[model samples]
Target: MTATDPRLLPFSAVLSSLENEGAYAVMAAAAAVESATGKPVIHLEIGQPAFPTPAPVADAAIAAIAAGKTKYSSPRGVAPLRAAIASLANRHRGLAVTPQHVVVGSGAKPGLFLATLALVRGPHDHLLIPDPGFPTYRAMVAVANGTAVPVPLRPDMRSFDMPALEAAVTHRTRLVVLNSPGNPTGGVVPLEHLRRIAQLAVEHDFWVVSDEIYSQLCYEDTYTSIASPPGMAVRTVVVDGFSKSYCMTGWRLGWAIMPPPLAERVELLLVHSVGCTATFTQEAGIAALAGGGEVEMLRREYRKRRDIVVKGLNAIPGVRCDRPQGAFCAFADVRSFGRSSKEIADVLLQDGLVAVLPGTDFGEQGEGFIRLSYVSEEEEQREGLRRIAATLGRLRPVKAVA
Candidate 1:
């Protein structure tokens, strides 16, 4: 453990950086505040679903465990689960995939990590990601020694800017990540925009890594898969999981659909890295796919909570929040207050006993905003908004003029 010891040498730069990710830092700070204050902090910082795993999935897992299914599954996952995922993707997303094209990993997060590892050859390759995007994308690219170029989301906060993407992409760009109903902003990309991006990828000969974990949570519009575009299937890797859609976060199961060869490579990566996903978890995933009604109920409930949070946030004097078309988060514009997003978020946590993530945690573009996850119960969501409104109202005298 001494500094001179070989083991004390610097760890992988990317792994070291992931330890300090803004979201995890804020969540830890929130926990500390709650502990010190002896009062429940309103948690709008984490993106986990407030609900428990659905009964069918949990039951299936328990049964599998009791039936001695504790052994290892294939790196591509159990055959039944892979077939289920393939069928679901083909039917819902209009993608033609088979079990052979599916690669299951521990979670969608790891699926993304493995995809980047398999796709990026070295530091010379570029991975184009969205600014104010899910931080994991950039972290994964870095872990694989790929240069990450962040393309800023449009000002309206609804979708990616085509012009910006066009400017960023080049022959050296190896991958473009598409997160519809994106994290932090909750802005769902339009289908036409995706088609255009798909065309651009085809022209540039870059791969597309589509994270569709939130596809089942859309409210105003149906979710569209970028892989559905003509001639894009072979070039697109669709990553999704049972966590968000089925309230199975603790289960840690996810799948990806890619061309057969790339899928094979990713499966190999999984085998070397984690060996395989847990067998019982894959069984639970099968039940989740069969029990689709649970997600529908969740979507309905989240829509109601989303409405509450958006309305409450927009009503604040210096805050303007756009109603997110999908996902369980509201990105509120707090630039009118002039304070840095971290300052505002800190004030909310310490003074208002409300914990929300600052926009800066996402990227530079998130500097003056805050992301509020409506993933808590309806009552807690309302209370969180109330605290935030009061906090912002108190700052109006000093911050409004800025």
Candidate 2:
């Protein structure tokens, strides 16, 4: 506990470096607003699914607990859960992902972090992420001591800019993070773009870490995976989980499929970071994958909700929005409503009593936009839209006082 002994210091370098990340800032603000107002905030910021975990999944967890299956399991994951994930992969993506290649952790984020650690090598190694991308990717890269290089996707919300991605590659670029049915904007990466990115990764000898947690939640087209593309398996590491797909966030269970060579290191990293996932939780995840219809039903509802939000947002004057193809978010360009996305978010929070994630929270390009999660009840969706329209009007170019 000496001052010279850095481990005993009051400050932590890792913790200090992550202080500027904005995901938690939005959460904290929402928490304070909810507590202070005592009126429920129309929460559009979090990426959580509003649907309850399926009865079957919940039942399985209960049954496992009743049967006293709470003991610690292997760091890699329980045999049956990983096997079920592999089976699901084979059936869905035509990839023969074996359980041996799988490693499970608390959630998809942790698995992603572990993948970053295992795949990112040495100082100044770089990972590519989409502009206005998942904020966690940048945080994970920083935590791994790897540089994050932005690969700006098309602003039209159509596909990844292949040239930008290809041009960003270098020897130090060890990982390329891909998200389809992306978070901030629900744009699905077209198969063609994925193929080009995969080809570039192959040519550059870099790995692709595909976060496919929202694979089944697409609206217009079926989900595709880099691993399923020809000649991609050896260089692609798939990170997925039951949280979004099964509404099983509290389960703290997610799994990763890595190239066999990297599987051991990822598992070891999981061991040191989290030791092992709860055995009962993995058991529940097995039940989720073994039966997947509830997720399909949820997807139908989300498609409906997305329609509601897109139509509503577009109706609001000066708030242009695109209909997202996948994921349950509507990224609306609200620059006309306010000077900044954060300002629009603040106005909504105060005037409309709704809180959405400002686009700036995602990245620099997100300044004039805001991400709205349409995971509320149908009635809430309609009412919130009404409120947003009225609220934005009130906040519009304030030349006069009411």
Candidate 3:
């Protein structure tokens, strides 16, 4: 056989079904556009916060390194950090968790993967994920060799379509992933919806993986967790991280809170896979948990950015945007222009030099919309809005007068 022969090796068939998050792909394409044209691309594609890590958080990490706390501690996490996480959970979500229930990982993705792997046995298992949701939930289900059932969002894009979600659940359903203040759309699941979901999980005897990375970024008066409802704390895995809230994306610190039994299993998974998250990073997480003021400031700034982007998008001739309740994205409706979301996104990138994601990148339900992250400065966001309006104006649809 030749060195480059197709039959040289066998790869897992599951690899063929896996799809990546669209943000990275858009980022790469934007980079190429910037390379080809001398103009800098206005970035609205990526979800990362533009803010720097707070000084106290950075100082904590530095102090830990100076104290030589660099070795692997416990797969469950260091004692102090775990305790801090549990305390934070209790304060925010009304949970009575303890350090024993916390398991730290490199990022929320690892905990999400481990939770799916633990619950999903094989292709017979079904996992319900939000349509117009974070892509990682589906990707993790694929990794676990399970069937992913997409639950479409309601027309308002504020929460799941309960009728659709109710119809999607079956005896084979093993898990459901929930993301409040969710990605792409910035929709916060209402408390009543969470209550209904909690009831379903109890009735169906399935697990819930609640991704709350954006919990601190909520613009609403309060944030609710599905785990807060009765009987949910035992079945729910609360996956959160310091990346989005603390601007510690590069630090790679995230954690999951679950029942002690499952926490043990997930810790074992951590031990055999990545071993443990960096000790110093966990120390930084402790500081982040204590530094509440910095987080509130970040949240306030994000709210301002959200207002600016939503208003600007709404002013465009064919574009309409709802004010996002939380998170830092503007999901703009572009169906009036008579084009697919991908086509609109491409025109925005190529013609306007603005980078954004097509809504279909989230799921089929996102067909007529596009997602733009408002994580950049207010000035940059306005500039991106200008480009989108100018580019899309050329394709504006004509009105038929009666």
Candidate 4:
């Protein structure tokens, strides 16, 4: 018999057409180039913080390991860690989150995936997500075999389209995913918009999954949780983690807050999937909650970097970047240059030695934009901007008229 074709592997259909997160793909490309050329590549592609893990958080995890606390934990998470997450949410977001409402997991991502799987019950179920939003939102819904409908953000780039959202909701709409201090754009959804969304969810009787991982990094506006609204706590699932605020990326721990029954369902999913988040990592999360000072220092530094990157991008010719109200990214519009974002990103990487994610990879509406993460060191951030400006500056001299 002839040799079988290698392409005929038994992988799921989702794997065949997966839309990967562009940031990580760019970061990996940058790494390969840096390694091969033995030159440092300025990384503005991903949101991995430049700071080391907070000392207190690291120490707590070490102590737990030294004390032989490495065994498997409850699939729902450790008791103290769940309580800590609940308390922090209540204190910070004015939500009535109790331990009963908390479900800890390996990271916010897993909880998000589990929530989507648990909520999106059938192939006919429809899930609403923001266009040009986090790539994982739609991916998870697809993995759950649900229809993913993207609601585009307003042209102003500050808020979502309320009328579009109202029109999108129906009995088939099972879940709506929201990201505040959003990824890539760093635009926070205002309280009024959130209130309207809450009202819609109440009327349509659909669940809202709010991904508030960047809640602590808001630069201008106060952070608000949709669950805090009256009659909304029971209908919202909050996904948060220690990766951003405490710079505990390697720790791999995060949690969810929702109604007790929903939390239990998520916990059951965790039980059947991965056993639980590592026990010691949960200890580290406990320390992070206790050490508020570390998070505050990080917030202050990210705010400064945010200002620098926004200002630098705006100063460049053919580029106009708005100051992000929250998070550590600056999404710059480069449509004026009449180039796809990927082409610009390639030029920056090859000529300028700077890496950024092309926005079009996020969704259709993300075309003509590129997302730069300002989570690098201050000097590196400045140098990356300089290189970006210098390279783009050369293009303005002969740019084609639109």
Candidate 5:
């Protein structure tokens, strides 16, 4: 083998299909620019929580390690943690989820991958994922060697454009991936529309994978679960976790709950993929799930930060942001600005030392948008938004050509 050829290790064919993800690139740029400028990077890029993980959850993990629960348990995860996830959903969502229906793993991310692996019947069948939704949705579909059909949403109104979505579905459709308190756009589908999608699922005989990871991170409205919809429970696979709610990202704990039948298949796949999450982490999950006030403190703080970021973002010129009803993000339209979303992001990084993800990172339709996360301290958010205003305010708005 040639010297240069040896430098590259052989990997899955999927490696070639993996395009450079834009949001990650944006974060890299933010890091490089801030390092060069010696500026404290006001990170509004990633969706991680602003507050520390609840103390009890951290304590439980530490305690588990102390007790020598570090060994791998089961592919289906520790029974206590899996049961805790089911109980939490049933109590909070008012949907009866049983331990037999739950399968835990490293995090919502891996659980999601397992769901995709278990759901897609063949390479030819397509999965419907929302446009401008979580980039991971599309990426996961590719990793599973399946086609991803993007169902576009109207960012201006922050809801699904029903007719467009309806047209995208074909006889080859096998799964529909829906995310509430959605990423990038922060669009939450109304109950009525959710039912309509469920109805369509019944008509098409397709399985539904609803991502409720942001279930707890909402404002102005109560969180909804697709499984709560009558008759949909059997066809829907609900995925949610302790990361966003309990601020337990590093803990790497999450669960996938499906109707009992699919849960079995999911467990088989999970076994081959991760064997199991650490035993101690599962114990910590139990602590997070049982009723507590620590999680509420984080919710309260995120709500405040959302307001802090939203108000400041709205005051910026050539940029208009919709009030997000849920999630710690504001979807701002920068179409009025003379620059494209990428250009605007670059200028902000160079001028204000602020990191914001371009709308285009989520979907092509997001070209005029920028996702501004409020997952930072209040004072930092205020300063970042002010810098954004100062930088964007100087640019003249350009009129679109006829």
Candidate 6:
């Protein structure tokens, strides 16, 4: 009866389907624990690099701001930045792309969201995403009003179960999202798997959205893109950014490379939404692309951290961790302790004063596991591992539910 009554306002049903990234929630809880106890907390939750932004990138942004480059630019991004992105793609991914094929966004997330929006039409359309993958993949599908079909990863947690993926594809499938050197698991898709996925996309006429934000951090001999397979270039959308490798998470610059026509539409979505990424950040992106030495050094450091985490986790009584081929997170199996991922993560944060993410935060497949980021200092990682082992040891194992 009142103007402000709940009955008068209807919210989109999609609101209930959305979920927050678990890292932030765990981060806050860890902060609260530290505050209450007046103790320092070891951080292994958030995924950003511990290194500062490379000096060249910081200087470029400052110079751009001083030169009065703060005004609005094309929603597609500044010409130089776009060109640099295209060049990076061509050299790294073996794709022939021009500036017209690039559409920049505030971060890799926007590019991923826009790709979903462009492909998924309605509930009738389905998007296949990895289970225990980046949470945003499902969130984007929900926002686009498309059905999300989750394909389980293989038991190794390194790649998709091909049989499961093939069976999941239906005529309604419009998009399939791939994150090589994926989040949470740190699994890198093998080239053979990429070829198979490419074949499936071509047969089903579904577009592939490859999230390669961590491509530069790969510990393997070589990184391959789904776009590199024949017939995939036209159908694959490569979403990447300067956040991870460049240590420029706050810069908020990312881009998608697609066919020229789709790039145009994605750019239009950009125009109506966030308008354009910050102009000075684009300048910094150009410098990041040009400076590869620091990127390699960071990759080497991450490899060392990964070794420390995986080895230490294995030393724990009931924990098992595989060496991550890429990315900076170690997905450790803690099921032997007979606790849910959330329960283990909470104990780690509240008792051990160490921050880590519950595996369920990624998806149902992440249950019985915990994700620990190795982006902190090497000593901090060791200390966090010690705390985790001690905290987990205190809890007696309960019978696992069937």
Best by lDDT: 6
Model 3, span 30-146: residue lDDT tens: 999999998999999997788999999999999999999999788889999999999999999999999999999998999899978877889999999999888888789999999
TM-score per model over all chains: 0.96, 0.93, 0.97, 0.96, 0.94, 0.97
Provide the clashing-pair count of each candidate structure: 0, 0, 0, 0, 0, 0
lDDT (tens digit, per residue) of candidate 1 on 67-180? 999997787889999999999998999888899999988889878998889999998899989888888888888789999998999987767888998999888999999898
**Least well predicted 10-residue stretch by lDDT in candidate 6:** 393-402
Give the per-residue Cα lDDT of candidate 2 at 350: 77
RMSD of each: 1.7, 3.3, 2.0, 2.2, 2.2, 2.2
TM-score of candidate 1 versus the correct structure, residues matched by position: 0.96
Which lDDT tens digits does candidate 2 get at residues 1-402?
667897777665656656455655776787888899898877777767777888888899899999999888898888888888888888877898888988888999887898888777656788888888888888888888888888776876656677787788887888889888788888898888888887887788888888888888899887788888777999888888887878887788888888877899888787888899988888889888878789778889999889889998888778888899887888888776447888888888777888788898878878888888898788888888887888888766533211
RMSD in angstroms between candidate 6 and the native structure over all alpha carbons: 2.2
lDDT of 4 by residue, 303-338 (tens): 888988888887887788878888888888888777
Q: Which 10-residue window of candidate 4 scores lowest in summed lDDT?
A: 393-402
Task: Provide the lDDT at 89 for model 6.
Answer: 92
Clashes in candidate 2: how many? 0
Each model's lDDT comes to: 0.88, 0.82, 0.89, 0.87, 0.81, 0.90
Q: Residue 323 in candidate 6 has what lDDT?
A: 84
Candidate 6 residue lDDT tens string, 1-402: 998999977778898899778988888888899989999999999987779999999999999999999999989999999999999999988888999999999989989999789888899998999999999999999999999999999987888999999999989999899998999899999888888999999988989999999988899848888888889989999999988999988889999999999988888899999998889989999999998999889899999989989999988877888888998999998898887899899889888999999999999999999999999889999999999989988885554322
Misplaced by over 4 Å in model 1 are 2-7, 16-19, 397-402
Write down the TM-score for model 4.
0.96
Between which residue pairs do clashes occur in model 1? none
User: Residue 314 in model 6: shift from native, Å?
Assistant: 0.2
